[model samples]
Target: MNFAFSLPLALAAALLDVTVGYPQAVYRAIGHPVTWMGAFVAALESRLNRPTLAFEVGRASGVFALALYLGAVGVVAGLVSSLAPSGVVGFAALALLASSLPAQQSLDRHVLAVARGLEQGGLAAGRSAVAKIVGRNPETLDEAGVARAALESLAENFSDGVVAPLFWIALGGVTGGALYKAVNTADSMIGHKTERFLAFGWAAARLDDLVNLPASRLAALWLIAAAAVTPDASAREAWLTVARDAGRHRSPNAGWPEAAIAGALGLKLAGPRVYGDRLVDDAFMGAGRREADAADIIRALKLYRASCVIQALALAGAALIAQA
Candidate 1:
């Protein structure tokens, strides 16, 4: 529960996730932790966010629902961690549970699919593959747009899907990680400025933003460092882009990693994009070429993989220091 134990636990979990991703068989049998959390989120939105309630009342209900979700996940994870036997077996069990938190392997698979689709198939294939990861409308995207969307998703998710969970685990062990994931799931499900979610999901959105603040910065650093060593990446551009253009992003935290990757790879990202009928006119990050392609996705994937190694090594170092 403390750093002495939790640091090593997190290191183990990250390694397991990288090497042995959550298997298809296991997922098919019981679904993943995130899926279970999604179901709970859906049920809460249905039961609590009623149209009949006043805006304030619905908002208050949403806050209460978020509290309930976090409480449930945290308590269960805490119990499991507490009841685990001492030594390797206990740590292994905890690692197995924690492995479910990071979606690194799955993220890689999803991004790679986009790259393959572009390389092997065509624009339609690329759009179909990118559609799975991004909320943007895929029908209108060209090949370059599809590649950009995939790369953008990779950078943002590297922070939310991988780094954020590890950050919480290092702080509060199983309980902390579980609670962070629950809140993040809530944000993804209902956190938006849309009429339906703007008021009702304010608390979840704000909390997710707060928890992700530090991790988002840390993720930026990871990418910058990884870029310094990568063959085609520009570390200087990454740092400059992050500093200059990250703030231009609509989401306070998402722009950091996205801008870093954009600068590192010398590609422009986050320009005008469509979501359904809505056109989001976001400022561009990284003043580089806007014509991204399948090759660019491969480069982004390399940067992503290198960043993962850096993160794992950093966590392992922290664990050793904690033990010392």
Candidate 2:
């Protein structure tokens, strides 16, 4: 089936994404664990094997975990659907449950919190907030460093959190979307460059990259389009920056939106960053404009809002087309 329910389902998913993720900080404070046990198991599996063996085990473990999660979600959706007042209500509930489980809004909020902390001259708070979002050490960062990290995360996650799941949902409805989320969760938890995960997380990471490729590009395009709508945003700059710098990053996908945002704001981004004890020398994107600051953070938020508008419009249009 082409999943004719995709459009409304996607809308339901988006709403659920917002609702579930927004309340997480409160829920976390109350010690309600949002932990993905499946991801933890996959991570452990990677740690127990030799390089090649680890890779095999990790891949198998990740796939199995993801399959199990998706299956569970499906079963739950089926049960809920059977009990719902209408087929439409059942499908909507399924979509909401599937899409709401991903951490997009929560991730965005965490990044934004870091930026806000830096803006308020709360360097310590900024570092603490940033620590929650990224794998890198935050204690050594200055204001600009923290802002850069948050903005970069905003760009990268625009693809991961929003676009990737949306793409799968468009293709597969609730079940397909849930499967993508499980794979992505697996990648996030175990896909790392560390010795323990290098072998095991390789498949999950690579597959995530593959799935995110098109979505990332689309995110970049949407960002550029969104920038075009703003009074001072520059589409030409965004496009040129993306063209020149999008390929320079370690990830095939992250560079797209980062470059677009860099170009749109007429500022530079993606230089050296410290991850744990390691220093990563990354290529700079965009032409030299101004140093990153709180204003840039506000601009990033604007881009984020614009992206949401675009997503909503696209989903609406898709629904109309489907109905036709």
> lDDT values of the candidates?
0.92, 0.74
Residue range 47-154, candidate 1, lDDT tens digits: 888756788987898899998888888788889989999998988998899989988999999999999999999999999999999998999899999999999999
User: Candidate 2's residue-wise lDDT over 230-277, tens digit each?
Assistant: 767888899999999999988888899999999998888888888878
Once fitted onto the true fold, the runs of candidate 2 whose alpha carbons sit more than 4 angstroms away are 19-34, 37-86, 102-104
> How much does each candidate deviate from the true structure in C-alpha RMSD?
1.0, 3.4
Per-candidate TM equals 0.98, 0.85
Distance from true position, residue 208, model 2, in Å?
0.9
Count clashing residue pairs per candidate: 0, 0
lDDT of 2: 0.74
**Candidate 2 clashes between residue pairs 3 or more apart in a chain or in different chains:** none
Clashing pairs in 1: none
